[model samples]
Target: MRRNWTDTVVAMLVATALGGCATSKDKVLPHGDHTMLDVWNQETGGSAGGGQPARQLLDARQGLRRPLIEADVQAAPANNAAYTRTAANEIYRQFHRLPNPDLVMYVLPHLAGTDPVPVPGYTTVFPLYQRVQYAMPGERLEDY
Candidate 1:
């Protein structure tokens, strides 16, 4: 009798465990009438056991089909031309300016090459210009 009772209790416990593993539709739907499978099928565009067409994703550029007009082109120039002449002048001045300033240097007396003759001290200037100048726009070398 004791052995039979234990076997029955064990079987009942196994059955209860298996039943607990089964999913209920209420648990998936929560507050709605639809089940988890229905929601998933709708989201993934999967036909819910029917002959319906699948939903398609839209392209990002589908709505931008308008052509540009002359007004757009005219407006563009003003947008970036606030300091056009000033910028051009500045650029021209920079390009026409000297790259390096003229430096006047004095050299001390030193031994000459090969013969080792005593060389006298002398002063010399370099660059000639105060600053290194660059050419202006469309400037010619002969212009300098």
Candidate 2:
């Protein structure tokens, strides 16, 4: 009986330990009001959820820079350039990363503009936001 109790306790301990390792990868994360440019700064260490790496944000920001910036936001040179780059980068980097639709929707307007594009592809008509996924242990950007 004592041996059986010891085995049961060992099994329970092992199960508990393994349970802690099971992280929810498919769970959607929160999308904050940041643009692609903001993503570069936001991803210093890891993401807000603590499960994903920060590099994803950086990559997303770089990937969408041209699309978001080229879109004409109609703001003054200073405001447009600054916000356009920042908003574009932040929104693209963090848009799809978050699980909450409310968060993504909240930042959408800020990333996009009111008017249609004056130059078609050169200007941005709709705001674009990206989603980020978590990386596994020892995983790098290429792995994803």
Candidate 3:
């Protein structure tokens, strides 16, 4: 009888522990016929119950389109010759080059270390090209 009581207590403890590990299925219900689009329409007051036209609710600028008149057009300045010439020149302008010219450097030799040893002098020039680089075809000038 003592052994049976011990076994019964052990079985009850094991069952309680396993039950605690099990998850509730009530909150995990499957999504039925309703989809994300239906939920959005309901939230935005576009459903039939709201009494608002669904098209107007979906597009806020439904009736805002209008034709431009002469008053809406701004007049161009009479003296646009300079502006036109500048604009024409700008069409061929290459603005991506380095502003400063390439530099030439000269290194002088000297003796150094605990024991004095002679080092030879050298000269070096920069900018391997003679002219600055131009914007390549189809290259984005704004990136420069």
lDDT value, residue 60 of candidate 2: 74
Best-fitting candidate, measured by TM-score?
3
In terms of lDDT, which candidate is strongest? Answer: 1
Between the candidate structures 1 and 3, which one is better when assessed by lDDT? 1
TM-score versus the correct structure, for each prediction = 0.26, 0.20, 0.36
Clashes of 3: 0
What TM-score should be assigned to candidate 1?
A: 0.26
lDDT of each: 0.69, 0.53, 0.67
For residues 1-144, what per-residue lDDT tens digits would candidate 1 score against the true structure? 999999999999999999877979789656978888987777655668322324232222445556889998889878777547675666654344435656889999999899999999999988866555576655644433
Query: What digit string (tens of lDDT, one per residue) describes model 3 on residues 55-90?
Result: 566466656667767655544443454456666667
What TM-score would candidate 3 get against the native? 0.36
- Decide which is better by TM-score, 1 or 3: 3
List model 2 lDDT by residue over 75-136, tens digit each. Answer: 44767565555656766433223232323222222233576434322323333435455444
Better of 1 and 2 by TM-score: 1
lDDT winner between candidates 1 and 2: 1
